[model samples]
Target: MKDRVTTPLGAVTLLLLLVAVGLGLSSPLDVNQGSLVRLMFVHVPTAWVSYLAYGGTGLFGLLYLMTRKRRWDRLAMASGELGVLFTVATIVGGMLWAKPTWGTYWVWDARLTTTALSLVVYGGYLLIRAMIDDPERRARVSAVVGIVGTLYIPINYMAVEWWRGVHQTQTLKLLGKVRFDAAPVYGWVLLAATIAFTLLYLYLLRVRGILAARDEAREERELMNDLQGDVSGLTPHIAGQGAQRGGAQHG
Candidate 1:
């Protein structure tokens, strides 16, 4: 069947660009944060996307363990990579916003520190998976890590409130709770950004999953060929031994 999902990936890319322009260039400047508020369009979405990616990774990892299917493992792997990408973007954008707002790029603030630690943990997950050669073993170990690593998500979200920090409390809420308080335009822009980032993540996930499956298939083919070659090499010796035994029996 023709892949419908990947076909729209390019369109999603274009849409994301439009959303970025609208959020970063057209959105009105904040009275307090001024132009620095523009960074929110990038920062907030990336942070949320990273959360989504990690969540999906954990979900797929669990699915793989239950089903023992390589496709589920591949999906988990793809999501993990996307998670790492967006996590890095979130950190970089946060640091950019911090330098101006907090007067320093690096700080021991709970939110920032927890986010950094979360990045390290996810990065370690990727590193360990790369070091292992066996696909099944790699998936098993990585799934365990993926599930455990997600514990950081809630901690990261609550860090600003749990401990004293300059980081702002969670602004977005459910059931019309306005905690972060911004202009109507900002809210609209945030909604648009969230949708755009989600589409981008799905598109990337589809592409990554395809590549991973192809790579796995190629590796399997190569392994099968190697085994066949070894069996072929042993065939002549076995045939000769059988022929000698036949002649000895006849004599």
Candidate 2:
């Protein structure tokens, strides 16, 4: 753990997080939402990371299907795990932000609903892996599910615009045309926050992938050990049966 944190990538991630926190703290209050606007610093970045992580899950899953490699499956699993985590964080942060803004901690608005649905979908992806014993079959099924689950990401992102729900439309739009509604300072702080969160996600993904690989290795070793133990126990029984048959023949 200490070795991981001391690595170059980890050091960079830590530095960026510190910078984002400083910028978010010093950022001016929103003209409307006041202090509540600060929540955007954490909320928006977490949402972005969730989207990124889920997207990676789908992409890596596809690669696994094409290549049939354990590494790809491991990466896909890691991405899915991180996706679920960030999705939960995003929901919690949003709920905190919403209480003051909308007077409620929960809502069935399109964006919120879709976001919740995506969380469930990925959660199921992890569940599927746990239920299946065969690694190859598990990888195949999980890859397909991961690919299908990613469709929710676009739907969730566009839900506010498509349904015109209580949730606000995209504050920063880059497709077709680039537009930022808030002050320039907000954008800068948000950019910093986004970068920091992305780095954090990458760091977590690498660590998780390594752990998954180790787990697979350990499980494989245990399985081999069990098979060898069964064979060794059967060998003595077979030998005794053969000796008894020989003795009966002699008598």
Candidate 3:
């Protein structure tokens, strides 16, 4: 694992994380949230990674369906797993931040509700994969599910705007009119954190993809070995029966 962490990509990801942490620590506190604003450094970036991971899952799932390749399926599965993990992280971080801000641990806000739905959707996707035994069928069915589940992303993003719930509207907008509510330094720190988290997601995705491929390959090998063993065990019994039949016929 030292070797893995020492690779160029991993090294860069680690470096970025360190820089983000340093910037976040040094950044001025929010006037409204005070030091609690630091939580945004973690919460926003994790939320971003969750979105990225699910998007990757859908993209790779589409590729798998189109090409019928195990590699694509593996990548889709890896992305789904990471997406679920990061979604959970996002929720937990949000809850931690919300408890103090909202005086409640949970709420039925549109954004929060939609985010929860997204978690369920991808969680179900992983569960479906576990239930299926046939690799080909599993890949096909899960690919469709992965692709469809991505529909939640847009809805989740727009939930605050559409429903006008307690959840705040988008703070950082990429397209059209650029909007950032926080101070410039805060935005800079957030940008750094986002870059770090994105890199971390990519690094984790690559690791997870490799592990998934190895796991599938290992399972296939074990299945083939079991079949070969069964055949070998039956061969002597069949031969013995054949000899007995020959003897009876001679008698």
Please report the TM-score between candidate 1 and the true structure.
0.91
Candidate 1 lDDT tens digits, 1-251: 78876877769777776976666688888898899988888888898999899898899999989999989888888998999899889999999999999899878889888888877888898998999999889999999889988888888877887797778877664224546456777877877777888888888898999999889899889999999999999999999999999999999
Best by lDDT: 2
Cα lDDT, model 1, residue 219: 89
Q: How many residue pairs clash per model? A: 0, 0, 0
For model 2, residues 87-145, the per-residue Cα lDDT tens digits are 99999999999998899999999999999999789999999999999999999999999
**CA lDDT of every candidate:** 0.85, 0.92, 0.90
Which pairs of residues have clashing backbones in candidate 3?
Answer: none
TM-score per candidate, chains pooled: 0.91, 0.94, 0.93
| Model 3, position 159: C-alpha lDDT score | 85
Off by over 4 Å in 3: 1-6
Off by over 4 Å in 1: 174-180, 246-251
Task: Write the number of the candidate with greater lDDT, choosing between 2 and 3.
Answer: 2
So what's the TM-score on candidate 2?
0.94
Report clash pairs, candidate 1. Answer: none
- Against the hidden true structure, what lDDT does model 1 obtain? 0.85
